[model samples]
Target: MNMERRGFPVWSIVAIVLIILGAITAGLSIETVPEGSRGVVTKWGKVTGRTLGPGMNFLNPIGVDVISVNVRTRKFEQIEEAATKDQQDVQATVVVAYHPEPQRVGQIYTDHGLDYEAKLVTPGVTESIKVATAHYSAEQLVTQRAQASDEISKIITAKLAANGIIADSVNLINYQFSADYTKAIEDKVAAEQLAKTEEMRVRIVTAQAEQAVVAAKGEAEAIALMAKALADAPDVLKLKQIEMMREKWDGIMPRVVGADGMSLLMTTGE
Candidate 1:
């Protein structure tokens, strides 16, 4: 009876211990990495230069730790107030889309933790905004917003890429100035437009006056030509006098005075 009891309890204990051991072994040998993420294995807080891809991965869990890093594209957005070359205060929203290089995941995690955005991208963005804004005046910044955005993108992207981060795109979403500045710009534009209208009116008046002078000169030239033609042929003057008399005569008979001092009745129509 004692042998039976001892054997049964011993076997039960062995089975229980085997189950626990099996669970521990399974836990240590197996790991799962989620999509859009990569895992870096480390030993004693030191990276082992090994990285694991997404899905089920086997690892030596007893002496190793896997740090899962998000290799997916991430975005950082910030609104910053900066000064232009003209000393105008401008506000801009900067957006940066970045991701860690998949092959450099281990190096990235070892060098900078998952909080790399705060450490690297933020400063790069801030500095880029300042550098870009300083090169243009307030008016230029507003007028050439696209160019300014491109410049900001170049500076930030170059800086981030040097630090092992891939910046896909950087953008200046919104660029604006103070309300007072906008109002001033509007007023200045209005004044300029008014000046242009007035100048156009003046030009029109001047052109009309020039046309009148040209017409007067044309009439004077016609009179001079007529006088010259009369002087060139004295008979033309007599013919013109006869034409005037014929136009003035009506049905009444006109008296014709001859050079011999004799008067005759001239009939216009029989």
Candidate 2:
């Protein structure tokens, strides 16, 4: 009886073994969580509410999933145009610093989904900027730019934290005003500078005029004192005239012709 062995073929056994090895290989693979990251594990597309830290971790081969959340600081920027309190349009470039809370990673993912950037972050930043900017006039916003940024940061930090997100800081990168408004501000500043310059010029001229008047008065006073001294001693005039002639002639003798044509000799040296 050519009874073929009813046992399974050797090739079939080998195929079964290969399939089992493949399943084991897939299940034994390790997923790596990078530094500054938190891993979230989900089972059957539902979050398991468990967070894993950085390193290699094992998850279910077919039914479990692992997602990495960035725990390090992150930055987001947006350029937005909105109306100020005075109904003037302004363009503001804003930057936000934030990081996902590691403990709340699963909840954040579940609530905001994987696209939290579009769902939560963008809207939060937009609302924060709008609300804070709406409280200031365009002029004040321009002048007190730092204060406006601080206000926006505070509002965003508070609001975002309440929703399980941590914001490190918010910055107002730049602000742009309408061309007409910018020109108006520039004109006003130029006018103020010109007025200041004119005032400074007037002050300088007034000071110079006062100094000149004082100098003239001092000279007149000195002359009057000399005249009074000469009057107190009548001979002082003759002595002053002799001193003046000595200075002018440099110790030389002079010949004076009088009104009757008589010559007189004047000796300057003793």
Candidate 3:
């Protein structure tokens, strides 16, 4: 018996080639989105308005593309110079922390495209700062930097939300004013402190004067009371004089002069 062997048929070879090509296309069509990212699917340069979550995703192998969108928190920093309510120039670096809405990335890409930070977040932060700064004067902005940051964040959050972006936080990293303005503020604060010191000194002096007046009045009243007591009891004076004599007398007769200029003799009491 003789065994016959033949090479692979031409049709089978073509079929294998086609199958390899198909496998390659299929591999290319599947996308693996990393953590903290989402996908926006588009067909023929038009968004399908479908969003994909993290992990592996499959799509049609032909004419369909998936764009990866970073849903993680991002930051955009810009220096904005705006006028306060008092028409004072304020320059600050505004840092905005934001992320695309994971569920709305498709809408975000469709409305604002991939450069949404420049188109939306940056402008949103700038305008929000401008508007929020207008609500306060230059002095207020400096004194209430934290409050200004909060207000700007609120404004930016609302503004961006409508466009499918989430503004996490807004921070006024650095705030500045004109040198002359800062000097003026310092001088004004010094003057206010000086004025307060003067007022305190005046109050102290006034209190001292009042205390002195009360002390003098008290002394005068004491003197008046003594005089009244002495007048009401003239015998008290005689008793006091007697006590003085008793303290000073010796055991001998004494000579005294009367008010009428007459000499008188007095004997010490036994």
Candidate 4:
């Protein structure tokens, strides 16, 4: 009697197992990189210096690993305290926007790894802020804030460039000082305003006094000139009196007493 075979041939079972293993190996060899991102490929925990762009890429699945690195711009914000040029303590809100150089991402990963922001970017930004803040006084930091931000950006740009990072922008959003310094600034401004008001009042009073003196001098000169004219001609006074009488006289003539005590009628011709 022929013995019933318990299962299929041994070769068939081995073929099925081989097929499943191949399918798993094929799946492991493929890697999909998303947009705005780059895959850093490594072999046996060693950097391969080969970057993969978006889409599927095939590589040896046995010892190769892929690390996704985002190439898009990223923001880093922190509040930093620094000393100003005038030895004043100040705090600033520092924001730095940066991104890794796409072509040099492999080198960046090799040097800085995944914690590049913490290791390189943060220290670079912090040091740049301190360096820039040292150039300006606390008051200038507030008044020339745009200038300060530009300086910080330039510093960070140079600092990060060595590490394969492109610093896009740097912003100094807010500034704070000690309470005593703030009060001192306020008091100084108030004093300046008060002084300006006093200066204006003094100028107005001086102008008024000068005008009064000019008027008095003009009146005195006129009186002196009239006295000289009268002394040169005594009959000028009598002419003046006659002119005044004519202005007040009616059409009728008036009777007056002459030096000899005789009554006489005074009349003026038209």
Q: Pick the candidate with the highest lDDT.
A: 4
List, residue by residue over 161-269, the lDDT tens digit for candidate 4: 9889998887778889989997887687689889999999999999999999999999999999999999999899989989998899796778999899998998758
lDDT of 3 by residue, 53-79 (tens): 889887775788888988899978899
Worst 10 residues of 2 by lDDT: 1-10
Where in model 3 is the C-alpha error above 4 Å?
Answer: 1-29, 237-270
Candidates sorted by TM-score, best first: 3, 2, 4, 1
TM-scores of the models, in the order given: 0.64, 0.70, 0.74, 0.66
Candidate 4: worst-modelled 10 consecutive residues by lDDT: 1-10
Candidate 3 or 2, higher lDDT:
3
Please, what are the lDDT tens digits per residue for candidate 1 over residues 1-270? Answer: 575666666677788999999887875577788899988988888999998999998887777888999989998999988899999989999888899888888877878887888888888788879988999988778768788888889988898888888998887899878899988877877898899999999999999999999999999999999999999999999899989988986957669888998998876552
Task: Pick the winner on TM-score between candidates 2 and 3.
Answer: 3
The 0-to-1 C-alpha lDDT of every candidate, in the order given, reads 0.87, 0.85, 0.86, 0.89
Which scores higher on TM-score, 1 or 2?
A: 2
What's the true lDDT of residue 234 in model 1?
A: 96
lDDT score, candidate 4? 0.89
